[model samples]
Target chain A: MKVILVGFGVIGKGVVKVIDKKKNHLKSKYGLDLKIVAICDRSGAAIDENGLDLKTALKVKEETGKISNYPEKGKNMSIVDVIKTVDADAIVEATPTNIETGEPAKTHMIEAFKNGKHVITANKGPLALYFNELTSYAEKYNKIFRYEASVGGAMPIINLAKETLAGNEITEIKGILNGTTNYILTKMEKEKLDFDTVLKEAQELGIAETNPHQDISGLDTAAKIVILANSIMNKNVSIKDVKLEGITRITPEALTMANKSGYTIKLIGEVSENKLEVGPKLIPIDDPMNVKGSLNVAMLNTDLAKEVVVVGRGAGDIETSSAILSDIISVYLRTKNE
Target chain B: MKNNKKQKYNNFNKTLYYYGENMITLDLELKDIPGELIRALTPISNMGVNIFSVIHLREKKTDGRVPVRVVISDAGNRLNEVINKLEEMDIIITKVNETTRKTDIDIVVVGHVVDTDVRDTIDRLNKYGLVVDLDLSMPDPFKESSARMKVIIETDKLDDLCKELDKISEEKNLLFIKSF
Candidate 1:
């Protein structure tokens, strides 16, 4: 199976590593000759009728962190050119989201589906911004459209909630979905470190980007929860559906007061009974969510289960990419079965 | 890094797999008592199919009952055998995923794969220039003694990483799942 890749960022590169590593395993396990045949980004796109060399591609991505130089490395063609040309079996849309406009990536995904290719994504902005329209096109085309890596990175919460918990109606879903806010909150609680110190550490660690408002203010969590809401609940929800709050102005006094009262603060994403909301809250000490530092993520208070907390390294090229691989394996398994 | 190292793998080769198929969920409406879920899951565990995911609880306070959803992964031929056993045990079969695909993948890494030697590991990754996104650490409640010591790689690693770990596993007591 030929795979066209988009958004050759950290997660995209991770997908390349695991896919290259497990190429044979995937083939033997699922009868899939999975090949990443194309890639697209803001700068440019790369496509090859023959399989793309993932290792070399990662080097180019690192050297310039852009897809502009792939043809410079003497590949066949540009990524967008391939999206228009390649008869790929699957499309991996990993492009960065322009939340304001939901551009380029969204256009690329629709084109893939229109051309009858399966679509998988790590981009949330488009989906969060326009899930209803895109999903309808996917269903209309009868293609496999999955986004496991979008919300929780590596946690199998989306699949677990969708397929595993398909029996009972999903009554509620909640978690410390954003690592940036959780990092700051965890630092405030443990070492008397203020939000500023934690934010600095997070940026250095890549958990929080340089401009971390989306992650810090809980908008990221809100966006993610709305997506999960639609997937698990099979309903349409928008940004307005999500009530958002940021931890921007949280004071040490507030943190100290929460600590004094035996509570810890966290930016939590929550969805229940079709009512979706996300924000920072003071969770009690006894809450199963006393999860501190960077390792905090959980699906809480399901009518069918109290909580299925999957805690781990939330970010990393490989770790988040692990979710992509899991989805790829799933797509391979499904595709091969046909 | 897709490193195919000079290491051996004692892997479970050539296991006949059933194509996409539904795994049964033995849903039960039991009282929200102390040992309800454990009683259900423990028996299923004994029966052999790996529990992929499980959930059970009573939502409505008005009605005191629990709904359980258990997703399992296993080969067929034994599929009927497992279902028969669950039925014999009076396990109420609930929702079933008609045709689900489960990948044969597990993550096993050196427990302290990046402990004191964080820089070395980062350097290794940097060779491939794989961006490390979300590698921040949490405060260990039990922050024990430290050395540049590598702990056992037990649970999960990318397939290529598995081959590399197999080479150094013997020297480092890497508790990898499938290393020769």
Candidate 2:
């Protein structure tokens, strides 16, 4: 499987590492010889018609923090150029998310589809912003558009909904879709500390991002819920439609009060056909959704399967990349079946 | 509600097996010896038969021997080997019952379907067999409402499923009426 990997960020590097580590295993187990044909980053592009040396490319990126220093590095070649010109089976889009515009990643996805290439994106921006349009484009071209890593990292929730739970109608989706806030909440509950103290600790521990507005304000969860609503629930909803509420108002006193009532405050994203919302709701402490640390849990309410709860690590380079790799394998299997 | 730490089902039940191999219950008589029960189970486990329940009917024993009932599920034909091994150990092989009987039944559950946790109700029904379809009517859920559910289950355990539904209905103070 020849792949055009766009973005040499943490997730991109993680995919390269996985492909390299699982080279023989993928071939022996699944009969898939995944190779990186083109690697494009913000700095420059690395192109090899046959297959680029992934190990050296990764080492170069690590040392120089650039893909342009890689062997046979191509200049003046845009991400769109690689998607259009590179001879590959799929495009792995692992760019940082820009929920506002869905940006260059969205444009790259459109171009990949236009060029008759399959797409596997970890960027939630494009999907959360224009899921219908992009999915239609992929379907129009009869190509696969997989983004399992978009919502729940390595949890494989999207595939679970689309495949495993296919026999049943998913009535609603509720989950903890952000890790930073969850860490804060867990800390607040455990130590009985205020939100600001927990937030500072999380920042120090590198759990929360430096600019934590997206996470603390619940916008990140809103984007994820929008994606789930659009993709799984088949709802034409956007972030604008979701009633967003952050954990900023949750105080130690309130958390303790809720705790006394056998409940814990968790930032939850819920999606139904007609409704989409992300807010700090008081869930029973015994509920599986009330997990500790940065663990993410998603519960899908279905008619047949009942309430199928999926818990997973929602972030990390390797974890998120695992989801992307699974998507790649899914595309490969689909193409093989076709 | 969304807080993100992600994990998935490590031991996912393979629903595909339900179609090929049927669930079964085994009844055997074994001597009241330390290794006798263990010896009888070696063959069953080796054959990859999933044991559902193992009931040692000690009170119903006769002449230093006890009747043991084992409920297993598998698609493979390995019961002969199991019986042969039990016979070698001087254990009696009483019966081997397969749960392949199929039955389709429709049920109407009344009163506050959503407020009473309809998802839990559907999930409970699905544990028996396949919940074929469901039609819910809740014009106003705050008031009384109902759901018409269709289920295709193994005929042998139809009564068990009904009893479970009855318990749920009684506990929730709802009406569970099975329609022919």
Candidate 3:
């Protein structure tokens, strides 16, 4: 399978490393030989018709800070240009999310579908805003679109609900989808520190971004839930439809009070029939949803199965890349016969 | 066949019937003090209700109260009477059968809890639910103070209580962190 990587950030670099590490395993286990035809960054794109050397691509990105610096195969080309002219079977869109306007990534996926190529992205912006529009384009062009890594990082959700639990009617989806907020809240409760103090410590440790507005303000979780609602539950909703409430006002005294009542506070994003909300919900201390630290946990309420809970690390370059790689192989197996 | 008999017990001399074969459960919250458990169960016994099992949820004891689940048989039509008698004795009945009749909701209010007329805030919330327990901490009067309150309300009125909290939040510039 020939693939194009649309972003060369941390996640993109991880994708290259994973593909290189799993090259032999993929060939031996599934008889699948994958190749990277193009890797695009802000500077330009690195293209190779036959296949790009995975090591050299990473080295160019690390040393020169741009994939376009690859020996002689690199060129100054736009992502759209590469997607439209590149001869590839699929394009892994790992661009950074723009929640306000699902731009760039949105256009990238649309162009990939129009140019007769499959798309496997970990981008949440386009899916949150233009989910139906993007999916329609994929369907209109008769292409396969997969984005399992968009939500819950390495934790399997979109595919697990839509595939493994196929027969059960998924009634609702709820969990701690963001790891940064979970980390801050956990540290606050454990250390008896104020929200600002704990958040500062987290930002120093790189668990939180310098500008952690999206993660702490519940916008990130809202976007991810919107995707799950639209794709897995077949609901036509966007981020605006979510009733959002962040954990800005939570205090250590509040956690103590909640502990007295056998409960803990978590930024829970819940989507169900006639309800789409993201806020600090009281989870029973011993409940499956009360996972500590920077771990993400989700509970899918199904009609037949009753309830299913999945817990995993919600962030990390390689952890998220693991999900993207799985989607890549899935696309391969599905379209291999064709 | 069993005979239904009228019995007079206690100082009130209220006529109670010892009859029927219905089994029911009462989730009662008792003060963590001596004789409170026996005091809660005596009312049902006075109504000629036979006690089946009493399970003490010791692990769930919070705020100086212990939850006791009492199962009784032979109450039948006297179930309401037993509930009324318990209420008359100031015993908190949290649930009847598997249905939650009353629930305790804990909320942490941040902002000028005392400056914004905390009494009025409690009074307004009391319209929908009883604000039974309150704990306030003010690290500095110039800064926002946080208050934790436990409101015992009927399960059906939860939505109304939340709506009231939102209204209070908007009116007084207070943030209510609620446990639902």
DockQ of each: 0.01, 0.01, 0.35
C-alpha RMSD (angstroms) for model 1? 21.5
Best by lDDT: 3
- TM-score for candidate 2: 0.66
**What value does the lDDT take at residue A102 in candidate 3?**
93
Which candidate would rank higher by TM-score, 1 or 3? 3
Candidate number achieving the greatest DockQ relative to the actual structure: 3
- What is the CAPRI rating of model 2's predicted complex? incorrect
- Fnat by candidate, in order: 0.00, 0.00, 0.40
**For each candidate, what is the lDDT?**
0.65, 0.81, 0.91
**Candidate 1 lDDT by residue in tens digits, A1-338:** 78888777767788889888888887787777888877766677666668878887888888877766875434435555677777788888877766666777788788888888888888888888888888888989888898888887777788878777677667777788877687787777677765688788878977789998778767778778888888887778887778666776454545554554345667778888745777666566667766776765766456666567666656667877888877877887787757
lDDT of 2 by residue, A47-144 (tens): 98788998899898999888888865655578888899889889999888998999989999999999999999899998889999999999999889
Q: In candidate 1, what are the lDDT values of residues B1-180, reduced to their tens digit? A: 233332222122211231135445544444467886777677667867688677654442112445666767753577667666665764544334543221112112323444535465445433322322212222352331111111222123333443454445444442232211
Q: Arrange candidates by TM-score, highest first: which order?
A: 3, 2, 1
Point out where model 3 deviates above 4 Å: B1-22
How far does residue B27 in candidate 3 sit from its true spot (Å)? 2.1
lDDT of 1 at A46: 66
Pairs with steric clashes in candidate 3? none
Pick the winner on DockQ between candidates 1 and 3: 3
TM-score of each: 0.62, 0.66, 0.91
Error of 2 at A136 (Å): 1.0
